[model samples]
Target: MARKRGREGRFVSTVEGAEFFKVYLPQFSSHQIRIPPDFTKNFRRALNEKVILKNKDGKTWYVEVKETPEGVFLKDGWPRFVDYHGLKVGEFLVFRYNGSYSFLVQIFGTNGCKKEKFGPQNIATHVKSEVESDNDDSSSVDRSKLFKRFEEEEEDNNNEFPKRPSFVSPPSRRKMLKIPEEVMNNENVHLEAEVNLRNAEGKEWPVNIYTMLNGPTFLGRGLCAFQRDNNVGPKDCCKFIFGNQTTIDVKILRH
Candidate 1:
């Protein structure tokens, strides 16, 4: 059973068990991921040589576990799991361990929204192609260059870190903020009713979306209170990160 949270609409497992979250950081989290020591302490003994990682869709991957003095790390087959998910830096993952060796994993993008799972066949084909390409590489220098280029391109196109939609508030629009046309067209935001604008400090202000006679949408009600509380001023640019339909994280830049 899954319970939904209001902030990002992420599903939380109702089953009581040991769970831990990790933010994917390529520096150390790419090849291997260490389970938190506190979470590992829940286990009576060492983990099995292999454990099952099941996604919400019921797909499972068998990953090798390595016990070390530092902590327990998911190794070996872990890279295939990462590649299959197309996991990127800053993405969050929650691992809930059942009493058995199986763990249910849920992945979330940087926007704080749960990521959609790709079909198994598609990911398998992609990973297979990647592995074949890697094996065919003869020149180390060429392979390294190609890898660097791939990383750069991946970073540029990563949806998890997409450029935030922003607009500079003019003096006349102090009481209301217009939603960008591109933002409305984007599925990341659902402005049918209202959205809560969250700041860096985690403070939130509920603002309503108003449609004008001309067909444009603007954040009207409750925006004044948000501006007053945040000290928003003219010429200040506000960047909006749509976490989901109900929540948007806001960042302000002073002019």
Candidate 2:
């Protein structure tokens, strides 16, 4: 078998006679999607219990594969994938097996065009700031005390730290951008508020945050203007830095 490096930097073996199958999602198909019996015959003996589903943009989701008399089906983690991509009934999905235990998936809407929301962006590495101090006796003592005090305060506050940087790739057709769940929970942003989106050039766009009754929070109202002014596209990745509850620094990375 021939080996090739994958996008995740791991070497994978090329499977001979790799195949592709398409599925048309019907009503109530969010929980689990069945794989065609004929398609499973291609590599049924070689199939693994767990498989990875990768989107066109290289984002991956691990789903459990169940093989029974009923045929093979994608189980756990499938619902989250459906919800994350906002899949609806009648949408079509293409799954191409990669010889390995992974499949590259592509979603198409009713218009027969690829869904722009599934076009993922590369997630940037988390960069942590390091504190520096002068190499002096008093400076060292002060730095040690500062760290101790910081740790004590963090413990007292239940170890809640500042929100880290995150990336968002908004769909071109969508008027609002969804803030990541981790960022929203960490920042305690659950109410409607007005915030400023500042770009790298110091240009600011006032955007309104709208919290849904039981859904995710989104940046709306002024997002279109911000996207227009920054020339944001579906392929571009925007890094969001939550400077404060009222300010978000955006750095657009063009492809």
TM-score of each: 0.41, 0.44
lDDT value, candidate 1, whole model: 0.63
lDDT of 2 by residue, 1-255 (tens): 456665445444466446565555655467888887766555453334578787775666677877667777887767646644657667888887875688888888889888875311101011000001111212323324433454565578785545454434433344456676777777444332556889978889876565544545666557778988888875555656776766787756565
Cα deviation at 86, candidate 2, in Å, is: 1.1
Off by over 4 Å in 1: 1-16, 44-48, 119-255
Clashes of 1: 0
Per-residue error for 154 in candidate 1, Å, reads 45
Candidate 1 lDDT over 197-244, as tens digits, reads 898798998765554434456665567788778887754545567767
Model 2 poorest 10 in a row by lDDT = 122-131
Q: What is the lDDT of residue 46 in candidate 2?
A: 31
Which candidate tops lDDT? 1
The clash count for each model shown is 0, 0
